[model samples]
Target chain A: MTKTSTKPAPIRRDWIAKSLAGTLLGFTLAMGCSGLLILATAGLSPGTRAQFAMWLVTPIWLGVLSGCFFFSSGLRAWLWLGGANLLVFATLLLARPA
Target chain B: MRSDYIRIYKTVHTWTGILTGMALFIAFYAGALTVFKEPLARWAAAPVAALEVPLAETPALIAKTLAAHPGAAKGFQLNLKPTEDEPARLSWVEREEGQDDHDTLSGHHYSATLDAEGNALVSESQPSQLAEFIDILHRVVGLPFDTDPNRWLMGVVAALYALALVSGVIVLLPTLVKDFFALRLGKNLKRMWLDAHNVVGIISLPFHIVMAITAVVFAYHDGLYALQDKFLHNGRLANAFNQQRPAAKPAPRDPADMLPPVTLLERAQALSPGFEPSSLQYVNLAGPRAMVRVWGTDPAALAPRAMGGFVALDPWSGKVLSRDFLPGTQDAANTTLSSFFALHFATFGGTPVRWMYFLLALAGAWLFYSGNLLWIESRRKKQRQGEALPGQRLDTRLLASATVGVCIGCIAGISLTIAAAKWLHGHVADLNAWHWYVYYGVFFASLAWAFWRGAGRAVVPLLWLAALSTCSIPLTTLLAWAVPGLGMWANTSLAALGVDATALAGGFALMWAARATARRVRLGAEDSVWSARKILPSCQGLS
Candidate 1:
């Protein structure tokens, strides 16, 4: 006998979502790399430390969004992990001295 | 996404890849080698003492030469110092006013030994043909004719490459997550090939995109000019554009006796604070229309092709006529343009950056070749049984032929040309001519060979030819060394050594590949033997 299978439908890709994701990826990668390079060369200014910290968290956000596109059982775990990392990065960015 | 869109993208990708893969392969591969052009040039002309002449002395030399040979001074450029690989060379082209033609004069190169005050002591030498050949290969696919068609063709290819990249990403979307970092070594041929293709494509996606975009910018510079004229400058484009363009201004027609070289230099220095005079040109000094241009370099301006400032000085009164920095518009645009070219041409930062770019470029070439292989392998089983469509089969064959012909052809042609350079150095009229002859001859020969022999067999032989030709580099060097008065131990010797080293490595690789093929043939024979025995036993048991 054949077994009937049911799974959650793939997320509908709206224009807004796609545009947001693409923009996020581009901005994050550019800013993150740029910030890291600057920081490595000359330590970050106190005024810009928060902004740099926010930029660093962007990769995690991208990882979560990318995971959502697939149908692996471990995807939920990946999303959760990515979310937690983003939160920690954001907290650090906010807490940095001006 | 809609299936229709995916289908359209797939078609676009397929067509583009089929159309432009060959040319792109050659350009990228040769370009990679060009990153080490200086080293290769040095290797070609080895055993010469390293020398550097001061910037100030060059003006004196140029002025002296101009005074002696008025005919040769027209539109001349003096390269002041030699880099590690190249000896300091002076090149001038003379154009007589009444004549429409220009004659070039070279081989007045000088190497410097430092004096007690640490100034240059000058010595003369000839140009290196090997260096010239390598440059030609990088610039125009080593074609004999002008670069107009090649540039236009590359523009179209670059557009197609961009299309391919976009479509490839679309097709790969569904499997990307599962297969990211996946390399299935053991399995069906198609699967293995696909994995390899996917991994390389993803890893080097950024490089491929940059190459495609930069290629378009370089190849379609005319289009950019047209666009700028139409949009940026409005309908009065010509007038607006000309104002920014480098216009030749007529100098005063006074017979100002040649001013002191020191005074002219001082004036130029005063105008441009940081830059030292790199070269000086005196226009029509004897009769009328005399002007001096002192060209200099700005270390900070080395970020890209920002022509820092070339100051033109009135030699007689020490008046600064013009102080020009490469136009701001050009610099802003060239930030992207120059960086892209620098990245592609491997001229960004010094040796480390160039070496990195070289390795990346080679990887990019491999990526293209593997992509073709993956496509072919996907349809191989059907193709073998004649089940594939006629058009599809034709495309597959064509792509295969191109892959073998262009890549291997370039290697073989360039190597042969370099060898010919040494052999025909003094014998050839205009030593540069031998470069064209050898390159074109080998290129066409390879193409013909590819057409005659099927791609399957052509690959092995062509690869071997490439390997052999490369090995000749060392042999050429040895020959140069053995022959007395050949300038073998000179700076040009390094170029020969580099070629030999590269060739030997290539030869060994080809030999190893040939050995692997032999081993595969043996394995196939053994498989047949086992199959025959198994079939006979099965038939007997059934009876």
Candidate 2:
């Protein structure tokens, strides 16, 4: 096995901030995504749309939460996910049935 | 991935996995048994004289039963093939007042049959809840009750479990190819355990993913539906699943006019040739919106739910009201959704799939157990050759004790309670409450014993206890048959026999574990917490 550096890396974890951002922002992002899908599938039956909307949220929420750690910093994670949530929810609001 | 990202993910995997390992162990172990829940229920059920109400007589039976007990008009099930679990031709459960919708156990069970004189013989029944008790453990991670709080806790654990899976995959990605399927068993036990853990985790990644995702969905589907109702459906999502018919002055309908159970079965079978009808669930039979759900299995297709799929029918005209959940007849979107349930519940591809799930679930339980051992081993303190033996770290010792206590205690507790189902039937006033008492009693006692004796000292004895308790399941059956004086009874059905067979094998496995653990404790390295033998400096030279 090759020897590697034992010193600490030069990156910040920001665990608490990252977790908070991931949890709160990730949820909104998931809800927004599901809302968009529900609006897009308005032509389908209500039961089908409801099923899709309900089931699709968890995977998306978890995906965002998992990906949150990959962000360079917690602030960036919050900013990007917050922006995505805003855009998606705006589309949902605009396209939703009156 | 960057090396620092890999390092961060490794930390994530370790913390998430350690936090949920024992709870997930109990969940997976109980879940493995729950895959054969019907057989377990059958094994625990007291044998009764079979009620031979034929298919042709079900209509008359239903009418007479409804006439005698009008409350049953809300819902009643006509069992098509009466097994040891449901020996009666007709049975129904009435939920207690103010009971939660998800609570399946707190209900008044009643079964009806036609006597020799052709009259409805309705009797209140207390079917054994051993299987449902185990199922509750599986659903809520060893919690006694299936309440919202317990389910929400389970949801949190499942979320962490999913995170663990993803982070674990990422951590392994660095050496994914080099260590793929490598099981090097040698002096380095940590490496061996790690290899074993990786093999199971990687090979069964898809299975674990399905379990984690479905578990989260199952726990939080109600809240998800509420959110959807508010945002997506304009607060009307609940109305979608329930068929809406314009009410033209609601009136009570006669149960006598409803179509027979056989006709509903025939219609369901005609719709899907592979669908084998198990029961006819008559919902709201006296109401204008009466419907019968033909519940059954389709071996060739995915089931939408654990009790298999159903096709709602208008009982009056035998018209198919809804085919959305019908297994073989689902649309593409429905099939995709049903695949989740079917994959998690092992409801498709018949008996072979169920067996495969049972083994995979057991393997999953082992994966959690081995993960804990790996954590403990990685933290083991090594003693130098010339230096005096150093004390192990407090955290590792405590964690070792807890891991053994919770996991082994759960195994012994479930097995002993299963045996008690036969032993304590008529002797107890409320057998169901006694089931809880026995399980918690053994579980807490085992935990206490583990702490008092230390994990190394307690592990072998606990393994013996688990083995003896599991062996008692089959032994109870043997005594029931061989010794007629015993009040316990045994069913000769294949399902019940299968339960006995499986328990016997599990018992031997636990015995082997005890022997292996004893060997490790006595002969393994002295520095490890698993070692119980004390080496004195003076005696080392004398020996």
Candidate 3:
């Protein structure tokens, strides 16, 4: 890292696209996780489980949303977050009560 | 490859901040005031009763209330110590056939008690929604949408805010240690501004983070609850996340021998030492199965909740029904979760914490504002050697005007509306309506005024207006006191007077801001967007 000469990062539009993907799509991914939490916390009391579900929602979503910028290419960010979002939503829908 | 990641995060940080800064400014500013919502409510409430109805006479009053409004017999609460505006009030919501309890607007809020002539005096008046309106502005930044009250929109803004926070940290990581506390106050205006912004931000990082996360959770709570119900509860998702209550169902009891409100409060103190009770909530006032819930604060409990404990009692039996989540009695998890909300609302540490949050929230607002100014300043075009014309960009001009318009407008709006509370009562069918009108009218008018005169020159007038509006709060209170016929001197508690004093202080602050802005416009850098003299050419765009 020391060998690499540091230069000011160039402002670009592609970063904006990645941020949008991370925010909108990453939220869906977090919702998927929130949905998935239901299966894991089945044994806990209704109160405890609900608390965990609520407490987990924001940080998890924000984490992935912020993480979205890690992908160098906007296309990769799209494919990665988009795929995860699709998978999560599908699982949530399938898990819906009959 | 590494640089690309940095570049990507930098872009995310900049654009997200620029997009959401204004909204966050409004939210933080309004939210800071909302921390003292109880006092504000007290200050704004119009006087209904001259004296507080004694606790001993409450049961009789309840009987009286039910005799007149028979429907209230089902479920109604007697306010133990109602605010100054409503002394000894009893109220219940009139719900449609199958309306949910959590929904606010679905039911008619009905309150009744005996008037001066011993007759049932009932008011079907709209409950004050002024503080809630400010809260909405804080949450959503006044974004437009179809839903009358939409939290999802606020949730989105919270998400964006969270992203900005993270990306900002990442962008700052490079020079973090060296420039962390530096406040070089030399010729570099941007440096000084940046230093102020960064220092304030970094110092209050934890507060901002907690608020951001909690806000997102609150805004999207319904969706999260629904998700929990769908996946976790397998469809039986009622009252899962309402960890706020001690118990959903109170023990059954006979109404004939119900314990008095004082006795219940005493029992609560006996049950949990160091717990100070605030209010008692009664259910089933005129039935055999009456229950009472007492709310109190525990100073020892962590900073996350107000009224840290509760004691549910069977009215007739004088028996303890439930004591869950009581400050001394609550489990670790409940305490922890409650702490999160308490921290966001500044409930813990009492007045001291609230004061700290108020100042920090103002600093947070300033950070966003100075961020916008820095952006406008950075984009100012460099003048050539031979060119006499001082260069300024169109976008900078527009953004400058808009920034002043919104920030100053909200300040003026809230101040004027608060001032109006002194005069608009009794004469108006609904005082809340008058509050709304004053607020929105001043807010939008300020916006129009800003754009019309241009942001650079408009600052002086707007600031003066803001000062006057804010100063009027205290002035009106004093006037009412001076004029005996106005009847404002009665029941003006220290807390209510404190609101007036704070507003007076705010007005003085605004006057200082006006003076500073006036000076900056007259003598500052001619090429800068803040220089009012340079705004003459904008007439082309207007005419």
lDDT for each candidate structure: 0.55, 0.89, 0.73
Better of 1 and 2 by DockQ: 2
Candidate 3 stretches greater than 4 Å from native: A1-21, A35-44, A78-98, B93-129, B143-149, B239-254, B284-290, B302-309, B317-322, B427-429, B486-491, B534-543
Candidates ranked, most accurate by lDDT first: 2, 3, 1
What's the fnat for candidate 1, on a 0 to 1 scale?
0.00
RMSD of each: 12.5, 3.5, 5.4
lDDT of 3 by residue, A1-98 (tens): 13234664443446567767877787677767877786666786677667777788789879988887676557777888888878877876787666
Per residue, candidate 2 scores C-alpha lDDT tens digits across B216-288 of 9999999988877886678887688775674584676677987777777888889999888888898987677
Could you tell which candidate, 1 or 3, scores higher by TM-score? 3
TM-score of chain B as predicted in candidate 2: 0.98
> Residues B1-543, candidate 3, lDDT per residue (tens digit)?
366666767777777778878878888888778777767777776666443467776666666666677777567666656776445467787788766443443368777766666666677755565555565566567642214255676777778788888887887788889897888886777887778778877778888889889988887777777776775566666665332354455544434356767777788889878777767767665554456777777776643353345677766656776665566666766677777878887777768888898888988888788878777766877545545545578888888888898889989988888877777766788676677788889989998988888887888899999999999988988888789687554237877887888888999999999999899888776667676774454422321
Residue clash pairs of candidate 2: none
- Lowest-sum lDDT 10-residue window in model 2 chain B: B534-543
Give me the candidate number with maximum DockQ.
2
lDDT, candidate 1, B88-107, per-residue tens: 53445444455412112233
Q: Name the lDDT of candidate 1.
A: 0.55
Give lDDT: candidate 2, residue B113.
96
TM-score of 3: 0.86
Candidate 3 has which clashing residue pairs, if any? Answer: B27-B138, B258-B315, B304-B339, B304-B342
Superior by TM-score: candidate 1 or candidate 2: 2
